[model samples]
Target: MTDRHASAHWEGDGKTGKGTITTQSSVLDNNPYGFNTRFENEPGTNPEELIAAAHASCFTMALAFQLQEAGLKATALDTKSVVTLVKDGDGFKVTKSALTLTAKIPGIDQAKFDELTGNAKTGCPISKVLNAEITLQATLDQG
Candidate 1:
């Protein structure tokens, strides 16, 4: 397996200070975060947005892989992931993540698509890592 990494550096307090995060793989833009800005113009991308992106991409890829393994070809896969950060008892935490996916797969029935999607949700790396609940709504376009 290939290795990927990212780095973040922060100065001063959590709410007051700023931080710069860099994705070693060039997947994310460099941005800063602080009290004034949740995502800065000079620094890189925010963590929450990154997580959402990762989850979406991973889920899509997993579904495609599963379809291919099952001898089905996916013409298109569109996935949208929403990661919600809510107020917990003391601090903010990711409470839930919902994935909405539309897949156009050739020669695959609704039952097969549903099975593939279910497997993808469980197999996706990001989905497994997240502590919050992950829900997926998948639509398989036959035409």
Candidate 2:
């Protein structure tokens, strides 16, 4: 079992507050975020975007391992995740995460590809931890 940590420092109110996020790996060293970045689509990072990146990376890695276990190798795998946040009863809530994958696996059949991708989509840790709906769209490239 492995444990990872990240921290955030926030100041002021929710509407006008600002914060900096830091990860244990220091990949995000005091990255800035705030209401403007999250809601106004400013130039900065946001939780939803971070979740999207995590989901994409986790799902892709899971798929790679699944393919390896099945004795298949991929030339390339590209994934994109979109996380949707919406207003719920009294506050904001993450409603769903959608994954889009385009893969180049030399000797994989459509049926096998579907099986592995489906398994990865459900088996990835991020997917398991998320309370929102998860959806995947996968494409196999033979050319």
Candidate 3:
């Protein structure tokens, strides 16, 4: 098994507090995040966006490998994930994550590509990890 690590530090109170997030990969070292970035229209990053990125990357990778295993070579796979954060009880909660995928593969049938896309949507690590509802819309390139 493999492990990945990320940390965030917060000071002051909840709304007015500030924090920095760092990851084991160092790709997001010292990245700033806070209530303003989460609720308000301020600069910086938020948890939902991060989750979206993770989901998109994971699903796309899964599709790539699945295509290879099915005797198909994918020229491109572009995916976008939209994470919805909704009010639950008192605070907030993630209710759903929707994935949209656009793919290009040489000599691939739409039906086969769609089957693989569905498999990837359900089989991706991030998708499996998320308890919220997951949905996928796939578009296969004909040109």
Candidate 4:
């Protein structure tokens, strides 16, 4: 088994506070985030976007392995995930994660593509860890 870690340091209050996020890999080293970044769309990264990135990457990798196991190869697999956050009576809650996938795989039938993508959507580690609703839309690119 393996474990990954990330850390965040915040100062001040909710509306005016700021924070820096760092990951074990240093991909996001001392990245800034705050109310303006999360709610006001100021230009920095937010938690929801990070979750979406993680979900997209995890699902795509899972699908790649699934295809390999099925003796199929993909020229490209582009995936996008959107995480929705909403107010849940007392606080905020992540309600859903919607994934859109466009793939270029040779010699793959619609039935097989759908089945493999469905499996990946449910079997990905990030998808399994998320408590919110998950949805996927997959498109097979022939050109």
Q: Give the C-alpha miss distance for residue 30 in model 1, angstroms.
A: 2.8
Give residue 45's lDDT in candidate 4 (0 to 100): 87
* TM-score of every candidate: 0.87, 0.98, 0.97, 0.98
Residue 61 C-alpha lDDT in model 1: 93
Q: What shift in Å separates residue 99 of candidate 4 from its native position after superposition?
A: 0.2
lDDT of each: 0.83, 0.97, 0.92, 0.98
Which pairs clash inside model 2?
A: none
- Compose the digit string of candidate 4's lDDT tens values, residues 1-143: 99999999999999899999999999999999999999999978899999999999999999999999999999999999999999999889999999999999999999999999999999999999999999999999998
Count of residue pairs whose backbone atoms collide, per candidate: 5, 0, 0, 0
Q: Compose the digit string of candidate 1's lDDT tens values, residues 39-138.
A: 3434445667778999999999998889889998888999999888777888789877899998888888877778889999999999999999999999
Shift of residue 39 alpha carbon in model 3, Å = 1.4
Per-residue lDDT value at 25 in model 2 = 97
RMSD per model, one decimal: 2.6, 0.6, 0.8, 0.6
Better of 1 and 3 by TM-score: 3
Q: How well does candidate 3 score on lDDT at residue 4?
A: 92
